[model samples]
Target: MNTQTLEKLREKLHDNANILGNLLVETFHYIGLFAIGAVTAWAGALTCWEMLHQGTITVDDILLLFIYLELGAMVGIYFKTNHMPVRFLIYVGITALTRYLISDVSHHHRPDMGAVYISAAILLLALAVLVVRYASSRFPSSNTPQGANATDDPERAEP
Candidate 1:
């Protein structure tokens, strides 16, 4: 075959392979996100069921549900925008720490360094969330046009 013809055939094959690879990757990515969301919901439901079976809801149980909520929200955001919001993870951390601190204090009935440490961790996570929000607002991503806020773009608006 002529050199030009051979080059064209090679380019066509590469393009087709790239397209197939992208499709497969995207398909799996979506499937994985859906699975994560489903598992989070299932876990939350089981927690509720256990609470109901006990005929009482504790603060810890509620806090755990909130963590599941944040996880589901994070998964949903990632699925929709292909972007993970770091703030949600931080929120989860804060909630989990608060829950632990509460549980610890309630069980121990005494002030301890462990509670102090957990409180400090929660504060740090809260500060991290604030920093992230400030940075996001102050230095909007390149994907967003200048002077245009995320709210201006419905698709990019925070949930």
Candidate 2:
């Protein structure tokens, strides 16, 4: 009887530990999401504030703001469908690369050949975004149940 009681106690302890582990993991996940959201918001605000202080909004500032916007959108999508869309990152990259080209042209009377490289990079990113969009529409997720999200692609799903 004593041995049976010990076994029961061990099983209960193991079950409780598993539950606690899950709770902790969930808590950390939420905390991380909140941090990403809060930081993106803060950065956007700072960018705006800097533009105000400068008394003019430069293309660079606008591009920076767009990056923040993309980050926020990525976080929001992750929260909603638990999926991270790579196309947003590609969009952000294209914008950033274009911004670099603009910066080169604006700051330098004779823009260096580097501008060509950046433009090429932007084109690549744009192509990547198109490919991702095409792939997503062409091959939809098969794992989605009725009323369930199909945003998380199998290639991107966590193990």
- Candidate 1 yields a Cα-based lDDT of 0.85
Per-residue lDDT tens digits for candidate 2, residues 1-159, read: 699999999999999999999999879988999999999999899889989998998888898888889889888877876767787777778877887888889988687778878878888887887777777656665655545443445323322
Give the distance in Å from residue 136's predicted Cα in candidate 2 to where it truly belongs: 1.1
Backbone clashes, each candidate: 0, 0
Error of 2 at 153 (Å): 9.2
Q: In terms of lDDT, which candidate is strongest?
A: 1
Task: At residue 147, give the lDDT of candidate 1.
Answer: 75
Screening candidate 2 with a backbone cut-off below 3 angstroms (N, C-alpha, C), the clashing residue pairs are none
lDDT of 1 by residue, 27-73 (tens): 99989998998999999999999999999999999999999998998
Worst 10 residues of 2 by lDDT: 150-159
Best-matching candidate per TM-score: 1
Candidate 1 runs further than 4 Å off: 145-147, 152-159
